[model samples]
Structures are given as structure tokens and as C-alpha cells.
Target: MLYSDSNSLVSFNPDTHTITVIRNNIRYDFEIDSTITQQELFLRGMYESRGYELSPIAKLDSILHINVIPFSSDTEFVSLKLDSLNNELDKFPKTHRKTTNMIPSKNYILGFVDGESLQVYYNFPLSIFMKKAWNNILTICIITLLFIFLMFCIVYLFKFMRNLSQYQEDTMNKIVHNWKTPLSSIKTMVELLQKKSISPTDEKGIEKTKFILEEVAHIQTGSQQIMRALIDAIHIQIDRNEFDLKKELITLIKEEKTAHSNQTISLDLQYLLPTTTIYASQFHLICAIRNLIDNAIKYGKDAPQITIICYQDKNNLMIEVKDDGPGIPKEKQKLIFNKYYQVVDKNSGQTRKGFGLGLNYVYNVIKLHNGRITINSTPGNGCTFTIKLKKWRTK
Candidate 1:
């Protein structure tokens, strides 16, 4: 005969009068009466096994009732016992014998026949199986709640990133639109002044005014390029054309020198190639270069010296911008190109003042042109930024 619980299997052999139970990869055998019914095999095996112990009714303050009949055919040979109720065995009533039916007013009864054909009964106030089922239900509910919370966090993060991207695009639009009118007025004023007749001493003033106008023009061009780039989002669209790289570098250097005339900064250009022509987005490339130069001016030491070198190496054109500035630390070099990542001032223990978007923009522009940029610097020394691009030819 075989019987099963939620976690264990019990087998009983009437010829051998032995019971075997297997649970959690372990097996146990018990000796009992051959006449024990299959319905009571689990109870009989558990009671007879040395390792198995019965628990009292938890709801009834650890109370349990037991009744034993020495002979199945004779009710006269009976004995009774109560656990955790403080009553003598002899004083137990014979009329209160163990029955198969459980009474709601009394306790639940579980009975099994022993080896000598004796009936054993145990009364419990609650079922242990129901307690295990309730615990499993609670565990499932807790796991479900945790899954819901994680999904909500993921959704919220996605929406937050989308909103932030939209806000950035709107802000760029406003800035580009607002700067155009003033830049146009400055250009017109400079043109009008150049038309006026001036003495030889005022020639220097006219030249300075022209330089300021040129710088303002560069700013206007850069602003328009950035607006277009923002509209595309992530991928910058470039308008490629063949242009002289050497001429562009010279023009940018002159503009920076004029803009920061009061500062004792020197700008030098080195050309190692005979021709510096390339097919690229001239406006965006100029903006990227200007950002590097502006960063050097803002962060470099007193009377900073900046060098712009261009050369052709086989199939690639290389340009390097070197600055004699307070060098960047090794740890921060990789992170400097990330959007919104700023350098912290070691002396003041505060973040350096800037939007932290210049290097990110430069990186994107270079990527769109199928080029690469690298930084080489160490603390207390100078920094160098190298850009390599494929040389262009008429096809």
C-alpha cells in the first residue's frame, strides 16, 4: 500500500509489516502492524519512526489529546492520555473515545492503528497543511509586488529621458533665434564705419572694429550650425564640400587673436603637408575647432600658447590642437567628452564654470565626418587633442 503527503511518499508492505517513506532525496523505514489500513499508513509510519515527531495544536495553546485501544475487537481494553492539559490517564472518560468524525465545538481527530492492533488517536485544533498553503500564498504576493515596482521604475526612467531631450531641443531653438538679430546689426554697423573717411591714426580703430565684426560673424555661423544639429538629434547631418583646411585654420586663429586682444596669448599654426584640401562640413568643422580654442583660452595658464598643426599621413589628414594650459588629470580625460561632465577645480574644490557641452559637440561633429579624436595629457603638463580625417579627392 502507498500513501503520499505534500513533500513525502510513504509505502507500506503488509507481508513484511514495514513502512518506507521518502522525502527530499532521503528515505526512512518503520516497522508497524500488517493489518494497518492504507488511509492510516502515513500517521502510523510517522509515529513509529524515531526521527519523526508530532506537533501539538498551535491554536489551542499547544494542547493535544490521545486515545489508545489495546484490542480492535474489544472496547474494554482502552487507555486515554492528554498532552499539555494536566489530566491523569486513569481519570479520562471511556465515553469520550476517539471517533472518525470531528466536532466543531471540540478538536479535529486523526487516528492510526499500531503494531499490536491498537488504535491511536491525536486531536488537533488546526490543520498544518492549511498553514503551509497560506504561507505560500503570501510569498507569491510579495514577489508579484516587487516585479510591479521594478517595471514602474523602468517606465518612469524612459519618460524622464524623453522629456529632458525635448527640453534641450526647445532651449537651443530659442537661443539661436534670439542671437541672429543682434549679430546682423553688429555687421551692419561695422560696414557703415568702414565706409566713413578716417585719419591715419583712426585706421587702427577701424581694423579692430572689423576684427570684432568677423568674430561676431563666426558666432552667428556656429549658432546656426548648432540649431540644425539639434533638430536632427543624436546624429548630426553634414553638408560636405571641398575646402582649403589651411586657410580655414588661419582665419580661425586671426579671429581668436582679435577677440582676445587684451590677453597676452599667442596662436601658432604649423603645416606639414603641401595641400590641405578636404571634403567636409566647413561650418561645423570650424565650430568644433573654435570650441577647442575657446576652451584653451578659458582654462589655460597666464599668457597661454596654442599651436594648431595640420599634416597628411598616407590616406588620412591629421590635425592637432596643443595648448600650454594646466593639464587635465588622467582619470578625467576619458569623461571630459561625455555630455554635461565638468572638470572640478583642485584648488577651489568646486566644479569649473562652463556648460560642459563643448567637447561633446566636437565629438559628435567629428563622428559625423567619419573621423576620430584623441586626447593626450598629464597633470601639471600641457594637453594635446588630435583629430584624424580621411583625405578628400574629386571623384
Candidate 2:
């Protein structure tokens, strides 16, 4: 029995002519000739011990390229063959034998001695290093892409929220402006009544009272219109009634002319049919017409000439509102009916007043009646908005 390091133990069995080695908790057995000399046995044990120490180096050689050479004093004794698994070894120049004191140029060398001197050389090629780093490179690329996508989503969400906020603020300002005129009128009437200098029976007093009542009615109508719009936005059903289409247009034109009497805008109505009845929501239809007239008056150059032609063709009632205002650009005609999209004046490069919701509302109202609207315009040639509705049939 022979004990070497704390982890290695060797035992020889004379009867069975076998040697057993226990190293690092692993056991190896080798059969021997029954007449083998003690010196040969010792040499065999030394070889096995040295080979066990080189096992880790062999594993590294399988992953990299390593050269092993044995020397005796200053003379070359033996050189180990390249590992069969190292396919890249043949691509590089062969390693030359060197003296013990000479420094290696490329390979890393490790030297040790048993009974003879041995040196191990290891070389790390670029391809092998890149192969080991491939997983990290892929992980970095995926993380960078995910970060970019996240930033894009965040920026898009912020812009959408900003646009929504601006739209809401503009709508509120328009609502206040709309209500202010009637409210001011009501306030003036009450202040006049507070002055006790006039009798109730006086004609002027009665006229003042009537004007106050008219202002209140106007406020009520405005409130009702706002509520109707809100209901429509929520997709609620609207009430429909049958009415004379020609008469409705004539009445609406008169009302608009009276409302804008202070402005010099001209309103012309041409009726191709004396009487045409249509089943529709009268309030929404009137609102749609009013929006177009108001837009003409607001955006017109000087005395805007608006000509509205109402006629019947086949089974459809066609109404065309033509205005001789600064015409809309060809590019913007398609987007004008979209909510919150406003037309910009090409010459001045300034946006027109209003919330940009009027045309969109008109579009929605017309669609609710199973109608379609189309626009035709050229730069500086004025604009025409044409609406077609299915004629109501009485069964």
C-alpha cells in the first residue's frame, strides 16, 4: 500500500496481480503481470498520477487549441499530438521546438515536471471567443429594441393626450362665448326693470319684457342643441318627423339672414321644387344648414356671396351650398370634415376661428339621415358643398 496526497491512495494485490488507485474519491484498477518488477510498478503508478493531473488541461484543449511537449534536461524528448477535436489547429502555423529559456510569441505556456520536463501551450482564436459571446450579443440587441419600442409608445400616448386636452379646452371656450350674448341681454333687461321710472303698461316697458322673454327662449334653444349633440355623441337614437323640405330651407335661410343682419353677407335661395316633403330630424337638419351658413359668413372675404340651391333629382333631394369665399385648398378638402381638423389659410398661413367641430357635426347629422355630402373646390375658385338625401316615401 502507498499513500501520496491526502486525496490519493494506491494499493497492490500480490495474489490477484492488480493495482487499485483511489484519487479525488474516484477509484481506477489496472491488471499487472504476476512477475512484474517493483520498479516497473512504481513507474506505472507515476504515469497514472501525472495523467490524472493533465485531465483538466485535456478538457480545455477540447474547447481551445493546446500543444503539449515533453523535454529531458536541455534536449527535446517527446511532443504530444494535437487533439482530434481541435479542427482549427491545422489552419495556423505549426509550433516550433524552443529552449527552456526562450519566450513563446503567441501561445500561453504552462511548465511542470514529473520525471521529465513538460510544457502545455494554449491558443485562443477569435472565432471561438465570438462563439462564446454570441448569446450576450443577442440579449443586448433584444433589450435595445424593447427599449426603443417602449419609448415610441410613450411618446405617442403623450401626444394623443395633449391633443385631447386642447380639443376640450377649445370646446369649453366656444360654449362660454355662445352663452355670453344672451346672458348679457337678460342682464340688461333686468337692470332696466329695476329702474322704477317706467310703468308696466307703457309700450316701451312691454317691448322690453317681450325682448327679455325672447332672449330666455334663445338660451333654452341653445341649451337643447348642446344636449342633443351630447346625446348624438353617445350614439342615442334621435326623433324623426315629416316636414316640407322647401319651406324648411326657406325658413332657415330667413333666420340666418336675420341673425347676421349686421354682416354684409348675401344669402340667395333657389328652389327647383315648390314643395318637397322629407322624413328627418328637423332640429339636426336646421343645425347642419346653420353651421354651413355660419362658416361661410365667418371665413368669407368681405361680402361673401352664398347661393343655396334646393332641388329634387330622381329619388334624392339634393341641396348645394356654394360660397364665393377664399376657396379651400385641394389638399384640405378631404380632411375638413374630420373632427378637430381646421383649414389653414394658404396666403396668411393663419388658422380660421372656431373649434373645427362645426363641419364634423354637420357631417354626422347628415349621415344620421342616410345622406351623403361632397365638396368641390380649387384654390381661389370658391367652394361648393353638395348634400344628397333619400326622398321620403309615404306608404
Candidate 3:
């Protein structure tokens, strides 16, 4: 094989156990091919035969190359390029770093020759230990980075859960406090009316009494709203009565559509609900769907079109409500479902109130069903809310 550099030309034959060393018109014939069988034998023969007393192996088994060049007269007789000896040695099966316990070095090349019947070894003063050290350092760095990233995620998750638990507790306390005032007012009014007997024909007196009674009834309604809100928040399912969900949805849809024919919201059902009944509370599901439909009507900017779709795909049964509304802003969508929060007009900014419990109730209902609800909307475009429930089978 021919090996070349800017200053030298060298040739070696693996078929014959010989290497011609020539550089600057000088030549030397070397026959060091047969000393490869024994482990220490090669090192001894290399030092003795070539008079190149290079260490067989250094501290930490680091191999050093000894370059041998031949010369004769001022002009030189045979040229010795002293080609790198480790380049070819690397490709050999038994000469790798693990087997030799001697790492390769930089600024050095290794060459090995294999005859048809024997092998030859040549060495030069050069060191590959830097490569091995850098590889080990790189591996350590990667492992350290991975460990740090995992630790960060674990810490973040712990803090998030702790904060969420605190928030839920605060919400529960507020609900209970709001619930007591209306209930107390209702109780006081009822007690006072029971103690006094007033004639029904006392017109003026009866009118005043009716007004008081109406105020008391309004308080009762407010209290019921609070109680229902709390229940919806806590239980998710407003009713525990067993009913076939498909039949219930169909019935409720027909009634609602008939009652609100003026709205002209279209029903587009493509369902594959099993004939077998599901273990679900129908009242909560109805409430959830009704709330979604109401929101669609309230927010839709154009023709107030709504489409209700139900179908199953893969592992989930999906209910999708779509509307061409002045869709909610992405930033405000999450807060819109919070209790006592509502979207108001931009011009007048008038606040329309319904206790702000509708969406929250819907959220709880979906949660009780172990279903996921997602809203997709774009401002001035449209909105779609999809509910996904885990597929189940019942006999």
C-alpha cells in the first residue's frame, strides 16, 4: 500500500513480510514481521532487532511510537519515512484499547502489516490518550444534564399541586359563606308570617304582605341557586337517578328545540351510542349540554347558528357543540367558566348576571362523568366545544 504526505513516500506489502524504508535517496530493508505471536516477545524482538529502545508500554498502558529513519552520507542512501504505525494497528481485532490496555494518542498514526502467513509491527514516538479522556468527560456531562432536568420537573409538579389544593379550599369556604345569608333571611320571613294571621281581604295590607313575601321568595331562590352551585361544584352529577343517556338526550333535545323554535339552532347528530345503558346521571348530563347550548346562543354574533353532534371514535364517545359566535378571546376562555364571571358588551359593558354558575356547573357535570371538555375558538370566526367520555359497555 502507498502512504503519502508532503515530505515522504512509503510503500509496504502485506503478502510479503518486508517493508522498504527509503527517504532522501537512502534505503534500508527491515524484516520484523514474524514477532507477533507472543505478547511480550514482540516488544523484546522490536527493541533488540531494530535497536529502537522504545518502552513496550508506559504508565497507564499508554503506547508511544518510535519513528525509525535510515540515512547514508550527506546526501543520504535510503529514505525512511517512518510512517505512523498505529493507524493500521487500530483495525486489527486483538489490538484495540481494551485488549492492549494501551490507549491511542494524538499527533500519531499507526500502521500494521499482515503477511499471507505472518504479521509485522512498526512503532513511532507519538500519544491517543486524550481522545479516551474527552469521551469519558462527554458521557458524564450528558448524564448530569439529564439528572438536573428530571429534578426540575419534579419540583415544579409538587408546587403546582400544592397551590391547586389551597385554591380549592378557598373556593369551598366562599361558597358556604354565601349560602348562609339567603337561607337565614328566608327562615326569618317564614317564621314571622306564621306567627301573625292577616285577612286575605285587607287589600292594602295584603299588597304590602305580598311584596314582603315576594322578597322572601327571591331570597329563597338565591339560596337555592347557591345550594345548587355548591352541589354542582362538589358532586359534579346533580342527580344520581339511573337513566339511559341516549334516550334522555334525545328527549331533552326535542323538547328544548320545540320550545325555542324561534332560535332555529340545528341539530346534527351522528351517534353510535350503544343500545346498552350507561351508568350515568341523566340530570347532570342534561344540565351540561343545556348550559353549552345557552352559551352558544348568548355569544353567537351572526345568525346564532348552533350544531349539536354526538359520535364515537376510537376510545372515546364525543359530543361536540359548534356555533358561529363572536368567539371568546383565547385569554378569557378559561376565566369565563369561573363562578360569577361573565362576558359583557364592549360598548356599554353592561354586566348580565345569572349568578355566573352556569358554566361552572357544566364543568362539574363533565368532571363527574369523567369526561374531558375542550373549547376551540377564534375571535370573529366561530367556537366549538367538544366533550369526550371514555367508552364503556354495559349489558
Candidate 4:
């Protein structure tokens, strides 16, 4: 009593007096009669009592290979050659567009059935059973593909990281070799200087001593550069203490002026806040400020016009370092703060000297102090690095 729209082995012809069944292109007809049997009525009553309703979409793939015993017969079994019929069909598609799975699957329970169960089992087509069950086949396909792609990406990333680690180790080895020679020379010079005390009044000895001291200064500068690079490469730990922020900025400006005496430097300092005392690591904060100013000097073409703006906003102290220089490109702006990332100059096509860790160090130091730094720069307009810190109370 089931009807589906698609391909089916058995279908009905429009006739009230007869029932038509088609199997393998052959048709058979049976006359409808109102004959009643006591056992049939009993079985039908039991079937209806169980509330058994078969869906139209649920077609029988076929009966199982094993026999279905009828309660009416003691020695006879009704069987279907479903396994042999399935073997003659094409292989099941891995991800079939035409999704139809076998029904009563291999695990379906076998038992004796009444007349009603046998009628439907023999009449229904096996192909129709899978209509509803395989509906989500497309979704399954997409999810499976996505899972495979994710696994591929994870494997590629792991390989890349391993290669990067090896490269870093090799680079460090060469740097250490270069570092060891200069340190050895400095050590030897100090030993010799200690052994031979130059006479107090010898003019030639004094000039030689001055030359030795200048050479020692060069060695010290080299050592400092190496130390600074290492410091930037590691994590920053800040020791908090209260310090006058205004005083430190003045000292920073003066030191920059003294260091670059030949160049004309103009720093516009604006302090809008009446109170400047804040609790934080004074050394790292000043160093961060200095790095901003140093970057301004290093990248600026003309006499650098720098401005330091300090003010209070809500419960936070804000400092803005502005410079008149060739500004960063929109794309490279964020990348400038990444450790060991350097921006190649468009004009020179060469990156400026020193480890590219300066700005990265500045960012980490500010972050460690529970502060943040941001930048606003464009191709020709210059850069402004803004720092925000939570202003702690002195009292």
C-alpha cells in the first residue's frame, strides 16, 4: 500500500477490480475478493494494535538472504535472493550523489511474520528504502573535505616551524663566533694594560694610552650593541617604582641633542597634566621613549621636527611621540612592531642598521607595564606613536 514517485520494480495500474505487480519488466494481476479468515483477522488486529505504519519513502530493498517463516506453515520458509541480486549491481559510491543505502541492513533482526508483513515485504522495491536516510550525503561530503584540509594545513605549519627553528640556531652560531673574537681582544688588552702601568709624565706613553682608551671605547660600543640586541630578543620584566615622567622626558631630549650635536633637532614638549608622578618601571619607560625618538632621528631626512605630547584622559596618562619623517606605508605599519621585522627603505632599498627589535622591545616593555602603544602613519605625512599608561596615585 506504498507509493513513491521514482524508479520502482512494482507499481499499480489504474484499476479498481484488480491489483497489478511488475517485476523484471513482467506484470502480474490478482483479483480483489472480500474473503475472510479467522487467523487473518487475528493477525490484522494484532498489526493494527501495534500501530505499525510504513512510510511511502521507506521501500524494501529486498528481503534478507535468510528465510522468513510464516506462522501458518510449520515446515515451509519464504526466502528472497537479495544477496545475489546485490552482487550483480555496481559498487557503492564513496560519496554518492545518488545516495541509497541498503535497508533492513545486515544487522536487522530475523523473525516469523504474519500475512501482512509478507505482503509488503514482497511488493515494495528495495531501491526506495534509502530515499530519506541518505538525504544528508552532501553535508557529510563537505565536512569530510574540510577536515582533510585542516589536517594538511596543520602538517605544513609544523614543517615550516621546524625549518625556522633550525635557521635560527644556525644564525646564532655565526653571531656567537663573531662576538667571541672582539671580546677576546678586549680581554687581552685589559690584561696587558694591567701588567704595564704607563709612567705618569711620558708624553708618548700618554698619547698611546689615549689611543688605547679610544680603541677600548670602540670595543665597549660593540659589546653594548650585542647586549642590547640580546635584551630585545628576550622577555621584558619590569620593576615598578614611582618616578616623575616630565623630568625623564627633559633628560631624554637633552641626551638626544648632546648625542647628535651636528644635526639641528627641534622637540616640541607639551605637558597638559598638572601632576606627572606615575608608578611604573622608570628605566624601561625612558628606554621606550628614547627608542621612539631614536627611530624619528634615524628615519627622518631633514632636521627632524619632533613633538612630545603628555596629557591625562580619564584614569590613564597618555604620551604621544610625533615626528616629521617619511611615514610608514599602510601595510607595513603593523609589521614594524614585530620582533626582527625591518622595513626596507623605498628610496635606498636597504634596511637601516641594528637589530630590528627596537620597536618590538618598546611594545613589550609598555605591555609589561599594563600599558599600550599605537601608531598613526601615512606614506608622506609622518608618524605619531601614542602610549597609554594607567596613572597610579602618589598618595
The whole-model C-alpha lDDT of candidate 3 against the native structure comes to: 0.55
Instruction: Output the number of the TM-score-best candidate.
Output: 4
Candidate 2: tens digits of C-alpha lDDT, residues 203-280: 887677767767766784676467446534644233467878778778777756655544687899898964677777
lDDT of 4 by residue, 30-97 (tens): 44444534333223322232235422112122112112222111221122222222321222111223
Please provide, for model 3 over 211-242, each residue's C-alpha lDDT reduced to its tens digit, 9 standing for 90 to 100. 77677557656655765566556533132345
Ranking by TM-score: 4, 1, 2, 3
Q: Higher TM-score: candidate 1 or 4?
A: 4
Candidate 2 global Cα RMSD: 19.1
- In model 2, what lDDT does residue 390 have? 87
> In what order do the candidates fall by lDDT, top score first?
1, 2, 4, 3
User: How well does model 4 score by local distance difference test?
Assistant: 0.61
- Give the TM-score of each candidate: 0.44, 0.44, 0.40, 0.45
Cand. 1 Cα-lDDT = 0.66
lDDT of each: 0.66, 0.64, 0.55, 0.61
Model 2 / residue 351 / CA error / Å:
3.8
lDDT over C-alpha atoms for residue 309 of model 2:
90
Off by over 4 Å in 3: 1-242, 274-276, 301-303, 345-350
Estimate, for each residue in 1-395, the C-alpha lDDT of model 1 and write its tens digit: 34343566666777788888777668877777767654355555544442455432211111121121211211221233333342323312244555455332332222431221223243433444345467887888999999999899999977776566456544653653357546655666676676675444787987888798889878876875676466445544555689987898897787677556557989999989777777887767876887789888988877999998988888787889999888889989999989878887668565565667788988987897889999999877788999888745554
